[model samples]
Target: MGEMYTTHEEEKLIDIVLDSILSGVVIIDNKDHVIVDVNETAAKMIGLAKEDIIGNVCHKYICPAEIGQCPVFHPWQNIDRSECVLLNYKGESIPILKTVKKIKKDDHLYLIESFIDISKIKETKEELLVKEKAIDSSINAIALADLEGNLTYVNHSFLELWGYGDEKEVLGKPSVEFWQDESKAEEVKNALFFEGSWVGELLARKKDDTDFLVNLSANMASNEFGKPVCMMASFVDITDIKKANLLIKRKLEIEETVASISSMFISPKNIDQTINVALEKICELCGCSRSYIFRFSNDGTRMSNTHEYCPEGVSPQKGNLQDLPVEMFPWWMGKLHNGEAIHIKDVSSLTEEASAEKEILEMQGIRSLIVLPLYTNSELTGYLGLDNVLNTGEWEEEDINILSLASQITGAGLERRNAEDMLMNAKIAAEDANLAKTEFIANMNHELRTPLNSIIGFSDVLSSENFGTLNDTQKKYLSNVVVNGQHLLRIINDLLDLSKIEAGKMELFPEKFVILDAINGIKATMMPLAKKKDIDLKCNINIGNPLIVADALKFKQILYNLVSNAIKFTDQGGSVTIGVNTSNELISVFVEDTGLGIAQNDQGKLFNPFSQVDSSNSREYDGTGLGLALVKNYVEMHGGKVWVESEVGKGSKFTFTIPVENQITRA
Candidate 1:
């Protein structure tokens, strides 16, 4: 029981030393080298319990006892430092650094063994070395220079950038010598020295004395004493980017010039004037010697230059190029007709196919040219040409596209003018034809009604016994004459109504009327016909005591036409209904019928004068097909609209809406 615990003071001292430092500590007896005391850190580091390690022989667990020597040993040998591995509870080797010192406590000899886990530090050091190698191999030119501007260090990338064969070539060279701009070079150097940093684009000279652009960033490095030691810089080559920026600027300018010219064509009062302006702008923006627009003759045998521009030194080819034979340049004309441009970078490159055109172009000192064909209504009408007389260069695809767009814009202007002229002529002709129709209808109404009225009146008198008493056979024939005469009169009236409405001459005479009274009157008049056909005619007046504003005669005519048409088309034993639905804003009327339903496609033309839904039913149904047309015209005259909803083999509902206030009333 006494051996199980150390003295209380010794235990307290052990805890004080163990908790004071981060490293694991263990004390071993001198003779047996067994762990007599262990701290929490030592037990955790070895992955074991403190109780298990305190009584264990140090060499048996971790001191590589079977191999060579123990780290915990007597002071006479003085073994202070060594590194080894300790096996954890799981049998995994954990790397550690070991140091030993002999201590005399309570006049007893013991070995103090202390160590630190160095596994993570070892791994971190290895990763740092790898990253340093990656930095050295980077593509960016990396260099370090002393404060005196002599190169101290440079990677392969830096050596390669300066066209140096080896590091010795640039070891002591002043970095400022590589910068071409003397003033800017001094400015950057001053900034690096005084401000501790500088970054910008500056001109740099190569070993061959050729200049380039570089994006360089430099920083001043310092020692712990706060004195400047050296400078480090990273350089990126940007020579190609500078050149590309200039090219893009030129292209944008050309596009802007072409766009401005296209906008002027929208109100082109004179084609030649607008084209001349375009030629001037195109020649100036494109850096060309001459620009021209040529129009083909109506006979298609020749072309004449209608507009042209020249930049001072170029000869004027506009007048001399007029009326040239089109066949002489067959290849050129062929390209134009196919909507393809003729881009000749050099006239000398033309072969025998273009010999004729080449001779003409060379006579005007034109070495390079681009021609775009212009068409009005898809017919080749003209061509736009740009010529380079002094300088010859390949026309870039972008330049050619801009010129082609210009030609298309010109063609649109021509087409628009032609269309406007045609429309004006059409309007005049339509007005004259309408006037003639108006005169004919007026004369026919007088000439037709005189004879038709006499026939109808005479038939009526004969049937009424006013002239003489007629036999049953004669009366029957006379009744047919009167019925057909009335039908003929109805057709004539409908024609007149349609003509008046189309001519915008229809007038509405509005009057307030009792809607219910009108509905009852229509029902009474239509009852005999419905009874003969055995149809169930019905009326649903949802509006209570409603007084509607509309022309009395026209309103009655609309109701009569709708009811009559519905009755005529409906088969026997079917239903015909008149529904008057009123709202605060308007009056909606529906004439629905469960009849031989109209087809969906045919319903569109129902209100077109003389249009029948089914041509085959023309003989079966006796009508001029003008009733619905007149109904639509009258409804519209009172500021209303009409439409139909129907499905084949089902039913139909014809609806019309009239604003409650039909027209301005006259006192």
Candidate 2:
């Protein structure tokens, strides 16, 4: 060397170099193991003043080693480099990375310790560990692949999702191998590299080669230089989601089908035709080949296939299934009686107890079937069934649910049809009975009227004294005979007229007649009856024209019957008034009386033949209840309507309307 420095100068140079270093530095006396000098950085790192650290034993404040345990004494490892903790003045430990070297100057050896704080590096490593654990525990499957598409890392979730027990099995494998479509996976990878991210659904493959749906979120992973190097992907299993969506779609379809079928039967004009069309719709909805309805007999001992629907080339069983004995299907009927639905995915799978049902189903070539019992009026009336003749598969619950709804609709329709049939039969029977009664009355009319006329003729002759004159008692008896015979004749005449009207043999003999004259004649004829009850009989013809074209005889009869009824119901001294009004090609006639008024509830039955408000055997009024009914029929025969307005204890007003001129064809 060209230059040499003294010991004191060398010491000053070493101190200057140590103070300039960024890391902590300290000098220890090897003989005493005490700190001799410490740099400003060392004093700050140890949380002490330099003067305080310089005289302290190195083991107490700086180094953890005590006595002969110091690594500086080991010859084989004279230079020690390690991660250690430095004790501070407060007895706090500070993590550090340190290097120790032995130095000699002026015949004295020293241990120079160099160290740096490693707190920030340790904190960063802890944060990375937490993130790794989080990724491994995440529910979403996560994986990392290298630029060559080989899996470099996989989390526990990823291995579980792919059905792998260990990460070693997936690592180093091509990422595309785990995907169902390799080409699509590669396309996603290319897009991830080009676009930096990709997100969509993909069909993922399991370890067993089975497929499931997954939602994939893939992104390009970049190195520290910001260059894309690998791909990172996260997947969520969406197989159940897809299945739920399909089930929802199927449910909506079934709901729509049920609504369509329900609408068809709501107001069906022809129930049989509607049932057939409904069966077609149901078959198509359920993807079945046949549907049918079986009706239990009224006695419940037999069943019949009255309605059916079959696709082309499928045989119809309705024709052969008529009037089948109930005992032939014991199991089927038993289940139906319990109101339990029968759903057989495979007919051959039925148990021995259901063998009878199974045999019948097989005979009909049914592979799968469902039957829902039909209940009407709380009684098991029948059952509705759907069959699979060309295809066999388990029926979905939704399909069965929809068909169950359809079964209810069909049962209601059948019940309605049966009720209609019963009503029709009742109506026909009533009409036939009425026709026979009318014929009987028509035949009896001639037979009774001739004899009644002779009795009345002989009574009139005796009352006129054409035969021998009688004494006072005989004369009184003869008067009674004449009055009784006249009443009987009137009753006979009314019965004959009513029979003719009911048989539709009565005709309108139309002619021009004065309405005022007809009213005068009614007034004259009804005055006698009115006087007997001491009732006032008046006619009010309020019209500009009194003449009209109508059936003169029927018109007269209509007025007579109304006036007669008013007189009959009126109490003694009560008034009877016949009022007439005319408007625009029509005339209104009203017969009002001050009498015991009719009840409002009983007004509707006033126009019905033989109907009386007080029909009990014990009653106040005495007369046949046919006058008002006759009035109604005659007015309607002239194309008019009749009505009664009355309030209890008020009075009664009977009104009728007829065209001014007969516009209807004469009968």
TM-score of each: 0.66, 0.61
Worst 10 residues of 2 by lDDT: 1-10
- Which pairs of residues collide in model 2? none
Scored against the true structure, residue 388 in model 1 reaches a CA lDDT of: 91
Number of the top TM-score candidate: 1
Best by lDDT: 2
How far residue 200's Cα lies from its native spot in candidate 2, in Å, is 15
- In order, candidate lDDTs are 0.83, 0.84
What's the C-alpha lDDT at position 643 in model 1?
A: 91
In TM-score terms, candidate 2 sits at 0.61
- Over the stretch 242-265, how does candidate 1's per-residue lDDT look in tens digits? 789988998788778877888888
Clashing pairs in 1: none
Q: For model 2, what is the error of residue 260's alpha carbon versus the real structure, in angstroms, after optimal superposition?
A: 4.8
Alpha-carbon lDDT of model 2: 0.84
Q: Candidate 2, which segments miss by more than 4 Å at Cα?
A: 1-260, 263-274, 304-331, 346-367, 389-393, 461-482, 584-586, 661-667
